[model samples]
Target chain A: MNGGTNRSRFSDLVDDRVDEGVFRVDRAIYTDKAVFEAEIERIFEGGWVFLCHESQVAKPGDYWATEIGRQPVFVMRQTDGSLGCFINACSHRGAVVTPLKQGNANVITCRFHGWVYDRGGRCVSIKNEEAGYAATERSGGRFDLRRIGALDSYKGFVFGSLSSDVPALRDHLAAAARWIDLLADQAQNGLEVVPGCSTYVVHGNWKLQAENSVDGYHVTTLHSVFAATTAQREARDATAGMGRTESGRIKGKVPSGTYDLGNGHMGLWAQHITPHVRPIYEARAWLEEKLKPAEVEWILNRGRNLYLFPNAMLMDNPSTQIRLVKPVSAALTEVTVYCIAPKGESKTARAARLRKFEDFYLTAGMATSDDAAALEAVQDGSLGPPSQWNDMTRGLSDLVAGPDRDARDLGFEPASSCPDWDHEGMFHGFYRAWLERLEKGSGVA
Target chain B: MSTNGIDPALEREVTALINREAMLLDRRRWEEWLDLYAEDAVYWVPAWATEEETTTDPETQLNLIYLKNRGRLEDRVFRIESRQSWASLPLDRTVHVIGNVLVESAEGDAVEATANCIVHVYGKKGAATRGSRYDFAFRRIDGALRIARKKVIFIDDRLEGPVDIYHL
Candidate 1:
């Protein structure tokens, strides 16, 4: 690891020495309260963060409550068929407008004082407006609730930004948009988020999950138990001549790699399991009928773990899931995981998808619990003085150059070249983008 | 007609079975706990959702766990016992208290029972109290009451936090 050099205010927090392909981030970034607060302001508040799936608010009156950094926000479907993202706080006294996790409501009245707001976020009624002596105040829209600067959807995935100056959602998405297209293209009609998310909090920094989502390096080691169990099941199934597509078949060797999608986005791609065991495999004929043969092959053969910067991740193949990470504190993070499936899937395909989801990502499942434990242990270890810098140079030497290698590569476009599956280039790219956003001191528009 | 009220004799037998299952979990006797289930048993721990939400349909709704048969349950136990389950590496000390056992109905060979359970977990991180409602369907297999189906609804479902289901 290279020694750090002071560059910006948070330079002490991240050591980005790209010349030597060495990136070491200070552990304090995970445990320091001040650093956490600064991240909320400079990173999350400034960048485009995923809010919820469009299907969650498919109906005009539907709304799903979520947060960007510490700001509570809700995404509601307006009568005009457009989605409106608003701050959950009421303009009156700053109380939360909608307390429910999710529901349908034509008009949301603040629970505190019954200040009614329409789906468009215009304050239509203030409890006893006439008694408040606010004839001019009411007409001028003084009490209209504040709205998020940008709200956009790409392939049914919704994202909101707190800063208006941030780039458009399409520009923010960049290369990551291609992976999202792959995910949405699985279904002919579209994909829908399964109802009821598996929510849990981890005693670790939010970045741990961000890194873990694309960190293929830890799968073989941290989740060895899962691998072992799968191996045993496969042995037994083979002995019994059971040819059913089991969920826990261990893949011995397959081509895999990592891509550094631009705008802090990264993806881990690998070979998919047998078609019989995976829904994407079962939907091959259907997808092929609608899509080109190469497109169908890409959907079936490639398994993707796409990270949309700061928070959300879409895990495609093996099973489809959306992981949303929210930082509660420097050491406490909340995650809500949703299982998503392509619309109009056969009953057998949906069942297989659900089973595969349970085998991996569920709270009690083999993989997620293991990852959670490892992340918590990392957080605990970082609290001590033993280690200061967390190294992310595993596959840095093998990073494939982007399209604009001569200039500053924003990683906006995909390259035919790929890195080793277990490489740490994704982490390097992620932290680089994170440091840039922090240094810019505003949204990376 | 059979009485709708709890059957005293059946309640004692069912309560003992429930307590025995808890003891096996606390002691980490995974194989023995596995023996408490019949060959074709279904174990479900539904995700925490609103009161109106129906999690019975696992395909449509989310569940923390939904094991179809005894084989899958055995697989879960094997993972924990193999010392490969990272979450169960430093096994947390747990004490399960099973009470309020009510035998809701007793058919010819199957019995339906509800019990309130409180699991106190003590680990290196800290201690936590998890409450749940356990609905069980017990079948008399070879004159021994074995769990055919177990549906666990965690009372603290809304609280999104680390959940170690190894001992649940």
Candidate 2:
């Protein structure tokens, strides 16, 4: 309530009841349209949203169109080889320019009436001899498309924010940046998107999947089928399962810890609620033949999952796959899975990695089956009366507040912790930062 | 049999091979189905419709899925055998109907047959039942036609959710 007092009417329903070991949150957070609208303004717009990588638009005329917080935008490589992002709308009649997903174009022409613009977002041509259109006062900028307010990248992962008041991408990413770097640093030739996407739509809310990304608790209940199959590899001792900080990390990685970087970037290393078990060593000799020893080390082991708040997720080691979620409605979300491989990886090595990936996490996986079932069921429940509150109390007692009110220290018991708090931590941080942007008087940035 | 100037005998042999392969898949006789491939045979599925020229390398093309060489195909079969294979748990039932078996070319060492196929996949995992059709390619390897590629371009390729476990 300290920061959310001026938020939309929906925040008033938040059940702030916190017990010693757990916290009970209201289910209205998932069902309210007002809350959802607030989320688009606060979270999606206020937090750093991943757009694309430097590798994607490396040369001039190269462009990729996508959305950041419901605002359709395109990221293009300028003539000088620098990257810039702008709204995809045309200036003439507000039509979308460069509608294609990806292509190399020097001047993007609006299909509606052929109003053309250069790669630098300058409206260079207005067709049919329009007289006063060039001086139109309503245009957002020189181009009909508005430039993305803030854009930046760490390593090669480029991100853009809609709100001018949100924190810098680097400061917002905090500890999560190292995991993303490890993804590229550990790759043999570094990673690149493997051409096509494995896409599909689910009948559920977008936040459900975002929360599921780091919620280790669901592996036992919702993904029990996956557990039954992977039980062979699940940790039998206290130190083996998800709650333990050293379960999946290298023997000496991170010293068995969880870090809460301020501004909502959370790192739950070695605590992958699910499992990452594939025989990467079988291809190590084959990988070493094409890469240096250090590169092979990075490619074959160490890095795990990296999540930039809101919607993007990356798996660093074994192989790289990015899951980008786009919400179609309150009850439907479209998720696209792009498998990534090193630029010059051998055919055999690439195939092996792809097969291993499909075997474990693709649309053909046990966990995915469980998630689809769960998401649909949650949507069904939301249709009935919304629950008064949703509980997020698992590790509330262990939370040690830092000097910053938004920062806190905690242990790794994400599996049993309330509201799926480990995953919710970053989400809540995103929400708080987003709320600050919407309030007229709140100081942000 | 002679849909497009294809020789009768070659057409019969091609149809028989495809029917046998379909029978193998239906019976879950994976080992036998795999036997019909050439040692260096490549199995591919283009994500989109192709006009005779599409790269077989999954890395280069925007393919829905591709399996290179016999070893890779065998690996796919092995995944189904693995206990953890989530996609194949309720083993999907499919009927592959192959038609329009025409020998586009009868060049040396390899023969290409362009065919139309309607595959019906039926199964239930919880409450979800998924079925689809396939516009496919079958190639004559060492004189007998084999499933070089079975690409099931789903009518809803853009939808989100777990697509069913098996190919249609």
Candidate 3:
């Protein structure tokens, strides 16, 4: 009922008022607390959201804690090798079961009341069980810890949904699977998440980051410092006779475009640089030997920033990165970034990957630092009354259907697409999916 | 502990060098800061976690800040001085508290030293205090101590917000 009430108000906050072929969004959507709460209920809780990578919990009993719609949840690898995702609260007193971020544990015991649950989420033990409960109560299902509605993985990336009515994880991923395959296929032995993460809080709405993840328009302007540094580094390397420049990967003309992968998934594709210095490029022979030629071509040419609707963004350009966006408040978001690499790689290639990752994705990295500041500034400006609409109309005239190669090889129909990298069609497609989800109400109990 | 007491003059010189470096950083004298490093100097700020040992290997471990040589450090300073880094716009005013300077060892021309450092930063957002243990490997070059390697281990590794360009 609350979601329904907010759904009616969302229309007022988001104006489709077109001005000179530009679509404008009102400022209220970014600052409204009610809208934020509604989004948590309708979108986050009612759909399949990414949890953690399967490689992160490869061994049995390994667990990783995270949140789904503000509710603390965790995923653990069972003895049978299946993943079990459970609400982090104990069934007895509702206290958090495991407080640590991640670890290896067969039984997670609630420190509050000592309620223990196995990796399967079955209630296995309780402190003072005989004295605190009757025989009938002890054997009842009331004490069993609740499991998430669904748990599934595609290409080693785990996803969970809070609502049972939502489609399967693969169905939820849909056309996005093609890009996921390209990311995973680059590794000869599959991909693994590198240890450690960089986390920082930003004073901005969560949606801003989701849009910024795939928006290529801001790269040349907002990240001018990074561009300049790279150019200078390349020139210096060439002058010093260093043979090859590491920054050269980002140089020169690379054909770029954006594709709407449907179901709120979108991708920005750009041509890759030389393969000698890149790990993905270095894996070419192995990948060509393993996968089809088209798939290999996708891996070679497809440098992508792929967004999995709601929370996760996988970037294969510059370096492999996985960014998780968590909403703290209507005007606040916390981001966690992780570097991913091929399972087995030479030390030289791995080092190259790490260097590329640190160059742009780290907290002190040029690109992220700029984007964080810019987002906060935008949040500050949205409070003003003069500008009610944010225009997303660049490259609207160049919109085209998805390419035939995508349709034939990946089973992808001609979805919305644009040849230019700096297009607003991806943003429009994202918001369209967002509006549909918000209007559908919270279909989960 | 050293069997023989540290030379008071050596101690004074090392302490003075650190204090001068701090002053140069606070004043944003980019070129002077660059001159304090040897050509092969390494400046590292290792990542921190609650219950894990501080990472020392920049090649394998994640580091908040890792510069391999003087060229990388110079490039970093160049970015800050270019007036194009958005994070440096309206720069945060900072004061460095360098104290408890100790000469841990002296071998050949290289002297290993340890010190306590706390930086208080004031910006438009708010204020933040970053406390760290500074480990320095200094070698005498051109009759003056130049840093061969400087490692900063932050006491509280979890940052309160985005790290300023020059705070470390």
Candidate 4:
């Protein structure tokens, strides 16, 4: 809100004391418009963003529309069956060139001025070319959509960045890439996002969603209703068919852990969850056959909610949901939700995945609704003299220096690890990454 | 196109049942609202897949809500009754306006009808207006009319915030 008039105060927003084990985030980061603008430029546009999966645009001419920060963009399967990401705006007047969320069109015509673009990022035709302009005005660059600086796909997950200063997509993912391999490598073929999406707004800052995505600690309390409903239903022997998986009674928190997969990526993982009812349960035998003993153990029974930082979450705890988080303002965020599954699975497993997806993931679902409500409450209360910081120093005593025993056994190393799954320590890493980005963007780093 | 020999009592009964549904929902009479539904009721709100079309199959496609049986509804009601459903519990003040009711047919002990509904929800979060098309199939069970299926087509596909059964 101050817009950096008080530079010293802005610098002190995050109170991260590693030696003292104290981490407190200034609440202004959630409600300040200035901070939100910085986030859009530095973290979003200046770094990598999760675009749609390869399966979403599998064939030539297939396209998907999305937003990187607040900029409208689209990804398409080029005529040669390669992927291309571009600004959705026309080169002429900046009108959105592709309007549909998903479609197949080899050539797209801007409805505003009749500028046509080919699948390969070429300006095929411009309206009234000879009469309207000389050779210079008709240059290819002026007529085509702006191409993304770097576009890459890691394990079927596509990412785009406008700024070339960031790390490569694989390095950016860091330890989280192995975590994604857990989902992507589930089936012999890769994963595919189920058709159709649910886009809904949450009245809260995007960081609230970022924090909430990997915060396992809040599930027992915040989604008590979901747990209770599932508990009561199981107790009554009514949780049978109609897409309900065997996610047995979600009672108290089980033995779980958290991962600080550096570069702001993190995860909340629990073992011995209802593995029998998980949709992937059907493919467990094949997974064991294909993966190592430790990997199979981790992949089969463990429940995970992995955060890719800034913009996305891949969850498989209650069910499988791919969340694309977009910040609209300090107090508003939009989320695009989808059910993702192995590329080719049995009919029963596919049905169970979709059903479980419907059960507790969407805005209309039992769990996320509560999450949205709680987040709104957090945003509504993000202010004033009584409190300057959000206390985030949970489970510090249990934090291991680097890659705990389980992580080491799995052949992956995280920046840090925690025995307790619900610990808020992962957020400390998130805030650090966030601070670094904002400082670098503002030229203070 | 023509109402030739449509029973006046049937009209009154269907109209009363629909009106009572609105009144009970607005009054937070969840248990009574449950009574209006058959145990095997299919309460569905399909999600739009494209600009002009909704995803057709709930079994394989995405849906805003697709509770196939009354038990799922009961789970929602149970959660709301727990006073822990903060999403819509501590419940919103809702005024449901239902109109344009038309009876499509009457076959044996079943009746089919369609209507339009708009719910004005006011709460601490703010106010939201939800408009939808309600397709209902009512069946006579033990001398009382009960909803066998209720499909709601929401007017606004892009939901602004958390939406619950109360909102729809």
Candidate 5:
């Protein structure tokens, strides 16, 4: 049958022949509609998807709209100041309840039928109640905006899952939280999203961006302009040698490496070359008093490009950005980048933070445009003629098992580590975790 | 009728300079584009705080594009000229259409002008169009007007993909 030929198994797609020093992914995964559908259903919706930061909904009645896979969802701060998440669909007629992307809402009135819901998402009133639902269904949870199956937060980062079958948020996060701590603990009151976000689309598979975040191999080629521009600026500003990966491979003499922090979360770590560019460095004295010696050093100098799998990547270098990837289709990905900073930082530090943010983080910025161009070029090239397997074997020689002295310093227990930053072997954990989920979702395991 | 008390000769000068900037951008005249701005120019594009609100301050707030001086703009041109700028490597083509120009006022040697703009760009990822409003601050230097400050407010801030200086 044609069905059997067309529907290839997930394992066949990701050929992981690690014993032979080979791991490759079929290019069809980037273009096939079926694979995209399965990913949205299994990976994005079925598991924990990051909602917004707790700071986004800090005040009571504050509402933030987002999506879980393709399903529209909204999160709000209840009157009692706790967080609540619900499907954006109105209970009455399925129209979007909160149309505003972000705002404060004392009551959510469905424009479709005038069904009124309070800040907590409970149906308080309805237009002509007697004309519609009976006494049993007029009020209570049944007629309110539907809540997600599960919602939880870890250190101010909120996550929601449409299926209750998922593990607890902390368990799911694991040692990835240690990396998150470097970002979270930087703040006095906690980190804030800084009020605006840069949203744009990429004409490539989401996985391309997912891979690029933790990849150091492409640095010398894809963004030489960044290095050149920074070099000129560094000469002007006399930026010190803290540790800039953009300057290319530092080799030995530095604590630079990569970690597969379990469950597909991966990162590339380095002590910064120009640490002065980072706002956190300006707050070093205050942070040292609040945190341990290791944390102070790790948080300020040895920064990282941390991916929380599936959706978010907390980039602590180039700029502190929370980059969220939403797959619009197999070929298109919507990206939203927000500058996150420790609350109530100095104006000088804040200004420097934003200038750095503008330098590389946005679509309009210098480096990202080149990245977008390169990523799109890769996508275009991958689509031509015959399908082939992509290699992920660059760093196989450098791959190490379990936590290292560097990882142990931060209480991080990654599945694997590579001392060299440019190696490609760290991506194995990401692919393995991805394949496992898809296999389980398709019942192929 | 559209001069708004501005000298008709000065109005023509402003129009010519604006068109010159657009032509240089589309032609990939990177150095020429840099020359059009004053040495201490400010270029800013603010980000939307919400659907209806945009953050007002660049110093203590967020911005889509913010460059305080000509050095940053020079860096932008330098990147594009580096030929390794993949986003701008092939040198994307942009057709900048400007209309409804109004000279708001003349404050001594400086002039405030506003215009409606649409920049159609064709790049590696295909075509992207941006509609925006440009608020410019110009000063007459050596008997010619140079852009001292330029603020571009996008009609739709939810850009679909990567954008750059030439795009708007």
Candidate 6:
């Protein structure tokens, strides 16, 4: 929480334009309180924060506890078939209303004070109806649960904003909507969360983790442990002579690029996970034989995700990609990872898919190791005597325009290219939106 | 899955053994902790369910971690000592309360036992929280029960976070 002259240093560190394709970021963005404050005010508050996907709350009364900015909120499906986001705290004494990870309930009753609220945020009953504030209006002013300023959904993905001035959810999503639609539309049988949450807390600035998810550059070296492992090395070696086809897992090209999608929306397209790396193809083959041909294709090629600014990110790998970056401080962040599956899939298929994701990408996977190294390493650099600056200018001066200016082409390389410079645009777009919100003010959402 | 005939003297000895093991882990008695396991003991915390099949390779089961013998586990210990294991910087202090001990079967030297345990794990800065629930089995070696197979299924295993490098 270091403030004062350090604030300006942080502002300077984060506030810079991309001129020749290089990105210059100041060191204080990670350490200074002022910059973090402004970021919470502007970026985290001013943009659409991904709450959870429709799959999570498909059934009435289903709820998921998530955070938007610094606020701990839970989104629930009302009995009337609508979605709402409200602070998780009880109105009486501010204790967490429903402490469980998730479950189905028509109402949330505070265990501390016995105050009860229905899914619609109406104060249904007080512990002692007669003794506590005689004849008090339960559904009025200070009694009813406070909901987020704006609650909306794009396709089945739910998002909330605390800021009054933020644009409509779709407008805020902008070009990123296309990707969301592509991912959401994959499940013709309809998607549902796979009964678990991948919650992990890291010891680093939240932004560092967000950038790492889409950066694609750190994959090679940071994940050298995996690359060196016998199993992973064999996976890579197995695909050595596969004709270098881009259409399968790596996508159309190696130099698949990234771009600014306006309103803090950005995409790092084509940086796909290798199917061969995990037994995804083998599992899909097993599933295809047992499932309809169309169902098999949809399950296999669920495109990757970029994020809709602030704290949410779309992973685009079969399940939901909503990532909420809750900053614990200048030094710590907890990321709640959620995955979704087609609601109508057989029990066998669901089990197989969940197993695949859990094995390779959950808390204990090679992916978590990459994240652990990147975040901890960044924490080391930021906490130590501040360096002049860190360079994010990997793929500068090579911005070749594709069908869309934001969608440029990366050159020939492994689909899992470490630090794909072209993907830096997504990282840049996020920071730009973040800078705008910080210059503004903060409010509770 | 059944607790048939329970032995009083044997139960007292087994409870003592479990308590002693818990103390060793909490006290970071690495060598004594290693000695508690049989030579061919297995320590497995599967990433997910083992596929239902008669023949499936344990090597390719996609386990969170599956240590075959004491040597491999010692290698993990060796890495912790030699390398910078950040998660263990302050070293997590643990309290494993093992209770509900039941002997399922007795076959020669091996005795199958099932127990309900609650392990509270405390990080360096805070009070402990529930760690996991274990379903353990023991085998007799030299007239004393040693850990034959340990399966610790964490309630929060599916969640992402630092894993326990040391045994729980």
lDDT (CA) per prediction: 0.78, 0.57, 0.78, 0.82, 0.81, 0.60
Alpha-carbon runs more than 4 Å astray in model 3: A1-7, A16-20, A237-253, A273-275, A402-411, B1-5, B48-56, B155-161
The complex in candidate 3 yields a DockQ of 0.50
- By summed lDDT, the worst window of 10 consecutive residues in model 5 chain A runs over A243-252
The alpha-carbon deviation from the true structure for residue A312 of candidate 1, after best TM-score superposition, in angstroms, is 0.3
Instruction: List, residue by residue over A1-445, the lDDT tens digit for candidate 1.
Output: 1222232467766788867766788887788777777688888888789998898999998999988888899999999889999999998999988868789998999999899999988999988889975578866777898889888999899999988888889988878887788898888878898765677778899999898898877776777677677666656545221123333223344667777787788888776555556676666778878876656666787777999988999998568999998888889888888889888787777776776687788666778877888998899888865678898777676677773341122223753224566877667678778878887886634
Against the native complex, each candidate's DockQ, computed on alpha carbons, is 0.56, 0.22, 0.50, 0.71, 0.75, 0.17
Q: Tens digits of per-residue lDDT for model 6 on B1-168?
A: 224565666667667777777788777777888788888788766543311211123343334545556554554454344334444445566777877766666667776666656666665335545555455678888987898887765545323345653535
Winning candidate number (DockQ): 5
Question: What are the TM-scores, per candidate, against the unseen true structure?
Answer: 0.92, 0.72, 0.93, 0.95, 0.94, 0.73
Model 6: per-residue Cα lDDT over A1-445, one tens digit each: 2335446433466645566445777666777676776677666665678877787677899987876676678898988899988888888888878757567898999899889998987888898878757676674657778787889998888888766667788777876776665555555556555543445677678878777766656544444333333233334335342111113222223434455556666665443345442223435555666654544443353345576676777765433445667877777777766555555655544544544454335445434544665576677676644464677656655443323422322111111222243345455566766766665556444
The candidate with the higher lDDT, 3 or 6, is 3
Better of 4 and 5 by DockQ: 5
Looking at model 4, give its docking quality level. Answer: medium
* Cα lDDT tens digits for candidate 4, A1-445: 3334333344588898967978898888998877887889888888888987898899999999888877888999998877999988888898888869889997999998898999976788888888888867756476778887789998889999877667888999989998998888886887777766788888899999989888777777887778778767666655554344334224575778888898999888887556777778788789888899888877778888899977999887656788988898888888889888887787777777776777789878888888888899898777654556799888888888789899998877788898887688888888888988888873212
Q: In model 6 chain B, which range of ten residues has the least summed lDDT?
A: B48-57
* Model 1 stretches with alpha carbons more than 4 Å out: A1-8, A234-251, A403-412, A415-417, A442-445, B1-4, B51-54, B158-166
Which scores higher on DockQ, 1 or 6? 1
Q: Which ranking of candidates, highest DockQ first? A: 5, 4, 1, 3, 2, 6
Encode model 5's per-residue lDDT on B17-97: one tens digit a residue. 888888888888878898999989999988888878777899878899988788888887888777777776677778999
Where is the poorest 10-residue window by lDDT in model 4 chain A?
Answer: A1-10
TM-score of chain A of each: 0.91, 0.75, 0.92, 0.94, 0.93, 0.80
> Residue by residue across B92-112, what tens digits does model 1's lDDT show?
789999999888888899999
When summed lDDT is taken over every stretch of 10 residues in candidate 6 chain A, the lowest stretch is A408-417
Top lDDT: which candidate number? 4
